[model samples]
Target: MFMVYVSETQPLVDFLRSIKNGSTVLMASYDEPATKLSEEARNLIAEMGSTYVKSLGFRDNWVFVGAKALPVKLCLFQHIKNNDKTNVYENWPEIIDMDGCIPKHME
Candidate 1:
């Protein structure tokens, strides 16, 4: 498992593409993850099993678990908190916490 705080798109996209099959990826948002995020990056992450990647917006809190080249059913864990425009908190959404076990990948 690897943890990443997305701030840039190219580096993250490159890293996501380079990962080997079955590799687990953990992602968390910090500051503004969408300012520099590209459509390609969002599509790639969505393909990797993130349902919320496409809707991720500015200052939204997001956490996701995914795996390279794996079935979506095997790696589908995510949590998202959209920034509340009417009642903003510290210019960002509330933080999220998640805990679970990812089944070991078999060859």
Candidate 2:
């Protein structure tokens, strides 16, 4: 699986366009405030023929379109609102490998 940090739609669209037919994409993001992705991101993802996962309430741990075992060509994207302190996903060791103040949800 590939990992791509999605802060905008261009990169996402570029990656999607590069994918082969019948291939799968697995995406992950930290719904941070800085992420400026528009609704077109979702629309393009769907248009590119990739599945979208609805993984809410899991904080930093989520899958794209709720797909299992995301394909090898999958990508993970994220945008942090506050880059100075710590990312919301930073506390989740299993997801993000960063040493910083752990969020309460992780504790």
Candidate 3:
């Protein structure tokens, strides 16, 4: 199952509006400052001795922009750290459909 975990400060709202859920999404690169809450999410993962998030980039840093109307399978996970430290990152993924997000030209 894939998700589009949104945080307090999602940057690509307008861009995302162009796509539809269940669509095939492309993982565009992102390297911008994230919310303090988002950073804490990455830190939590790091503290657990996992380097996956580092390669995944900052929490909520990357947004789903482009898409292909192919039958490709993709699962997007929204991971974030919080002061609660309740280990809530394990079972939360807001699903985002990407099949319709694909550009017309690409189809």
Candidate 4:
């Protein structure tokens, strides 16, 4: 699953084009004027299909605006990290140190 935030159509199209078929995408943006699309964006997304649709309300800052969308076959784990680490990151039940790096399995 991929999470993306976009303001225009071409970038969204590029994002869709980059992903393989059967991939799932999660898209979010500030609620537009109830008429956000400029006809072209709507058409582009329509051609893309509902398998890639996910509209959301406004967020203070978009965390990942241009990352490649993820494949649907794999499960995805994603969350917004708190800008200030005085508290825990939003996705965590346990605490994460601000400057800690653990070894990855691939490494």
Candidate 5:
């Protein structure tokens, strides 16, 4: 598998839908100001995520959408042609290897 990081999902939806099974995508990283989000905006974002995920359906393909925090914007995409899939967390050792910061969730 290989990876791609995107800030917005709409632009990559087409390309993502065309990828073979066992692929993974990382999107919508939550940053420092995430705490400033209003409850209404959070609800809207959540709804949008569900819609985006449903639009791109591949049985074995996986997509990780997040409002989670990362060292930067939380985005990672894994490209797998056949069945060579790996745990999403395993893809980035640096997250675990960091001095004090541990990523709570991938998405």
Candidate 6:
């Protein structure tokens, strides 16, 4: 299991690319995840089974759990919109929590 707080796109993309197949990855956003996010990074995350990555916006709260090189059914994620009406704080969405068991990788 790996936990990450996405702040920079390059490091995140490199990290995502380096993980072995069947490795579990968990990611969340801090202040502003998309400010410096790149298309490659978004595509990478989307390929990891994130349905919301392409639409992720500034200050949106996001959390994702996925298994590298695994099927999409092995992924779980959620995001909270940071728009004016949905934000809990100025320019930020409300915090979110997620919990589940990921199937262990078997050789």
Per model, state how many residue pairs clash: 0, 5, 14, 0, 4, 0
Residue-wise C-alpha lDDT for candidate 2, range 23-58, written one tens digit per residue: 444455554311344455555564533343222222
Residue-level error in angstroms, candidate 3, position 41: 16
Clashing pairs in 4: none
Off by over 4 Å in 2: 1-7, 31-35, 47-61, 65-107
Error of 4 at 103 (Å): 31
- Please write out the lDDT profile of model 3 over residues 42-98, one tens digit for every residue: 443333233444555333333333232334433343333322344334332232333
1-107 in candidate 6: lDDT tens per residue? 22233444677678778988877878888776676778898888777778888887778889998767775446788788888986788777788988877778776
Model 3 whole-model lDDT (C-alpha atoms): 0.37
Winner by lDDT = 6
Tens digit per residue, CA lDDT, model 1, 63-83: 888887876445545555564
TM-score (all chains, Cα) for each model: 0.79, 0.38, 0.25, 0.30, 0.22, 0.82
lDDT of 6 at 6: 42
User: Per-residue lDDT tens digits of candidate 5, residues 1-107?
Assistant: 21222243333344444544332323332211133333443343333332333332222233344332233443333222112254343332112111223245433
Candidate 1 Cα errors over 4 Å, as ranges: 1-8, 76-78, 85-88
Report the C-alpha displacement of residue 11, candidate 4, in angstroms: 1.8
- Model 1 lDDT at residue 85: 63
Position 79, candidate 6: lDDT: 86
Flag the better candidate by TM-score, 1 or 3: 1
Runs of candidate 5 with Cα error greater than 4 angstroms are: 1-27, 50-107
RMSD of each: 3.6, 11.8, 13.8, 10.4, 16.4, 3.4
Rank ordering of all candidates by lDDT, starting from the highest: 6, 1, 2, 3, 4, 5
Candidate 6 TM-score to native: 0.82
Instruction: Look at candidate 1 and give me any clashing residue pairs.
Output: none
Residues forming the 10-long window of minimal summed lDDT in candidate 2: 98-107
The lDDT values for all models are: 0.71, 0.40, 0.37, 0.34, 0.32, 0.76
Residue 89 of model 5 has an lDDT of 37
lDDT for position 29 in model 1: 77
